[model samples]
Target: MPLKTVNVGLIQQACGADRNTNLAESINGIRELAEHGAELIVLPELHAHSYFCQLEDPTSFNLAEPIPGPTTDALGAIARELGVVIVASVFERRAAGLYHNTAVVLERDGHIAGTYRKMHIPDHPGYYEKYHFTPGDLGFTPIDTSVGRLGVLASWDQWFPEAARLMALAGADLLLYPTAIGWNPDDEEEERQRQWEAWIIAQRAHAIANGIPVVVCNRVGSEDDPSGQTPGISFWGTSFIVGPQGEWLGTASAEEPATLVAEVDLSRSEEVRQAWPYLRDRRIDAYAGLLKRYLDR
Candidate 1:
């Protein structure tokens, strides 16, 4: 195959309580990258509003909107005008009393390419997602676009190797993660460092294991816990793009908002996979143990 290079952009920024301001910032970031010749752009998870999952309030459900609702309409227009494919995350109100953390992909022509509902929902202190999102029913499927096939996943999904492998098996050219992760304000500095390093290492491992490039866009800055029980979360923004061999292509700032554009040679995945041959060596016939909750003797 011929070398197919694509300019991919990552938008990492902080979100405030104001919806319009957040949306505008994301749009501006997209436009900036588009002007710099990026054909594919990705934004941080839930760029339309603050990380409301910090504390689960029933009123937070109000933030959820339909797939073709206002957010898509707005992003679609920019995609059309800029002629860029966009991967954006949304708080999806699938139905009355049913919602999901979803990722929406817009083609360069401003049409809804495809959508992925988040399969993994994290439930823990400082990241109470189960209270707001229903686990995705839409399995691991990649969205096809002009640039290439995109394997889109949300925040928590990045931690699971199964998710990445499934997408790769389905023929994804590149893996994209729109994330909103941060540190609990009370943790020690060493603990925070370990957490951040683990996050980076895990994602890089996915690229090495699957022989596909990986892109991650994460939110930056601090968001206070609405209930005031805890100091709140300090979002560590280290958005990055890595090649098929798990080599860093480009990385953004850890403490500030950043816009990054990196040229990815899509054909490299084929070359790397041919050399690594990890997929060819899979023991699919003996992996029934993966389906069980635990293997009790």
Candidate 2:
């Protein structure tokens, strides 16, 4: 089905030590964006609490809540009131010792449409996700929503192309990434620039290669290590909306809070695919190497 222009809101903000304040701030941001004609709004990953992964304490598990829990209940009403679809990322406490990073889609009327669990959990410094989240077994499935198909993924999932392609193959018009990526405060300026560039370039390549719009909602500001273990990552707030052809509709600056609105002409996906024909001319018959654990022989 061909889609018309869809307006998206990228809520970029820095998290605070208070979860209530952060959640309230994010909800307000979404409503404000909706007021400004944002039909679909996406917020940063785990926007509720501070970047809790800064520490590895079992007590931090308190930050994890159920999907229909407090955050959804609050945000759903906002979506229903504004009649806007919301792509919200949260830390899910499925059960004791069973937590997952989940992205829940609330349709325009606030109905719980569906969800995509974060497939790739990262264990790098300042981001100890693997310590808490069990890697998602839901695979790479796109959820259907009132606005359009929402291809949702959490922070670490943003780097993988296979995840994006699977979503595109499953009929995703735009890829949504609720990310919590950043540079370490201690890193040199040059190293920080290189890391940030790599993050943006990788996602752009995903959009260009998959021929789909990519929207990433990333956090900004410097989070102090609550656990005092590793320093927190200074989230570069370049949350962007890239076209199927990888054109930047709009992007946020690296050190500020802002609401970014981008217009997506969803019909261009078909046009670009038709021109490149990359998906059509694929030799899927002989690409079995991709499934192998390691092709090193």
**TM, every model:** 0.99, 0.97
Superposition TM-score, candidate 1 onto the true structure: 0.99
Give stretches of model 2 more than 4 Å off. 1-3
Write model 1 residue lDDT over 1-297, tens digit each, in one string: 888999999999999999999999999999999989999999999999999998979999998999999999999999999999999989999999999999999999999999999999999998899999999999999999999999999999999999999999999999999999989879999999999999999999999999999999999999999999989999999999999999999999999999999999999998999999999999999999999989999
Candidate 2: tens digits of C-alpha lDDT, residues 1-297: 656889999999898878889988998899789888999999999888788887688888888899789988989999999999998988898988899998999999998898888889888777788898999988888888777887887778888888988888888888999998888888899998899889989899888988989999999998888767667678899999999988999999889988999889898998999888878887899989999878997
lDDT for 244 in candidate 1 is: 93
- Model 2's TM-score against the true structure: 0.97
Indicate the residue-level lDDT of 249 in model 2: 93
